[model samples]
Target: MYLPGPVYDVVSVDIGGQVLAPEQYRVDAAGRLVRVGGGCWPDCQDMAAASGEPDTFTVVYRVGLPVDQAAVAAVSELTCHLLKGCGGSGSCGCKANRNIVRYSRQGVDLEMPDPQIIYSQGRTGLSLVDLWLMTVNPHRLDSPSRVYSPDFRYPRVQQWP
Candidate 1:
């Protein structure tokens, strides 16, 4: 079975008829990696057929949130902007001014950006971040889709009934 998402750690792996050692593979934030063109076959194989033999290419790994550096940078930039606009230590008393009529506070007129427009337009006021997300995560799906079969039945604990 091909495991998806960012694999952080790999517990074990079996390929061909031999079990791979810890030194054979390395797990990183991005994914798991093994020696190229290593194992039973001449070339590295991602998947293998099921066999009654000892060699069953199987892998055990822990999948985690696939957050990349670009995403982190994007979130950080948005957070910084909010903190700068509104005081982080305490409220600056500058509420959102969404009204069309200009409002003045301390001789400075300000108008709050329309939240409805931003939401409807799917914009975060950050062009670069929006572009990155649009390219990297357009649908915003957290994980890959898994196929489910309704015909598959699970074992029942009640045998007498």
Candidate 2:
């Protein structure tokens, strides 16, 4: 099974209410939960045999990066801006004009905010979102913040010695 990756750590592994030790399994670089040594999982044709009596193997791990409220708001505002021009129109593939150019007796004018430009730089046009990200997570990392501690033990599958 393919597991979503960049996982911070595996919290626990349980089989029928029995918690397995960290040594029993390891998480590979590809983020696969692989059984190691004499683990409980077996290579058996029958599903019953693969799962020990009373059957159930559970892997508890953190999933996805952190998404704060600021990000949500930023995305929402951007979406709103993009959809602003579409008034009462159904989803008929019509989108708001990226560049609104108009001419008047006084002068010609243009009104457009390039969201693509902001997104390409890992930034949202919204000031609050950009500020929040800058304060909490600099470097514009798309992944969640990872805090490593010596006291905390994590299971790892070593593909090579």
Candidate 3:
């Protein structure tokens, strides 16, 4: 079955409280969990039962793209920006101005882009953070998309469970 990923690892798979061996299934390049052995996934599961209980199916996995140097740098930049003036004496010069759209003093004017506008466009005002966000999710998708085919027999998952 399709699992939302760039799946890094499969921790465990349980069917009816019994753990499946790694040999029984494999994660394909497309992140599909394919049954490798003769057995098949159950067509139906008990909705009321907790995961790992009898008649329930569960798969525990880790999902995300591997963190690289660019990601680390971006996070570091954002963290430094956030902590700039959080805890220190009054003389500390660093200040985070998240909400100032316009400033005027002695006939000189300074205008900053609206923070609301930036947020609406799925961008942070911070350069590194916005750059990283744009690079990773240019379209600003909230979640991965999925397609369903009538011909395909999808495993039944209990909605409430």
Residue 134 accuracy (lDDT) in model 1: 78
Q: Each model's RMSD to truth, in Å?
A: 13.3, 8.8, 7.9
- Per residue, candidate 1 scores C-alpha lDDT tens digits across 1-161 of 23467665667676665666777555433342534336332244434556323445667676665577888888887777678668744343235444554578898997656667866766676766787767786886667678888998654231110
State the lDDT of candidate 2 residue by residue for 19-115, as single tens digits.
Answer: 8888777767666777778554633333453443345666678865556787777767667755863656634223646454443555756554576
Candidate 3: tens digits of C-alpha lDDT, residues 32-85: 787766889888999999998999999898887668888898999877765765
Q: What is the lDDT of candidate 2?
A: 0.64
By TM-score, who's the top model here? 3
As for TM-score, the candidate ahead, 2 or 3, is 3
Candidate 2, position 119, lDDT: 77
TM per candidate comes to 0.40, 0.38, 0.52
- Cα lDDT, all candidates: 0.59, 0.64, 0.78
Which consecutive 10 residues in model 2 have the weakest lDDT in total?
A: 43-52
Return whichever of 1 and 3 wins on TM-score: 3
- Clash tally, candidates in order: 3, 1, 0
Please identify model 1 stretches exceeding 4 Å from their true place.
Answer: 4-11, 14-19, 22-59, 64-68, 77-101, 126-128, 134-161
Better of 1 and 2 by lDDT: 2
Clashing pairs in 1: 16-55, 17-55, 97-112
Name the regions of candidate 2 deviating beyond 4 angstroms.
1-4, 8-12, 17-56, 60-62, 78-94, 102-161
User: Between prediction 2 and prediction 3, which has the larger lDDT?
Assistant: 3
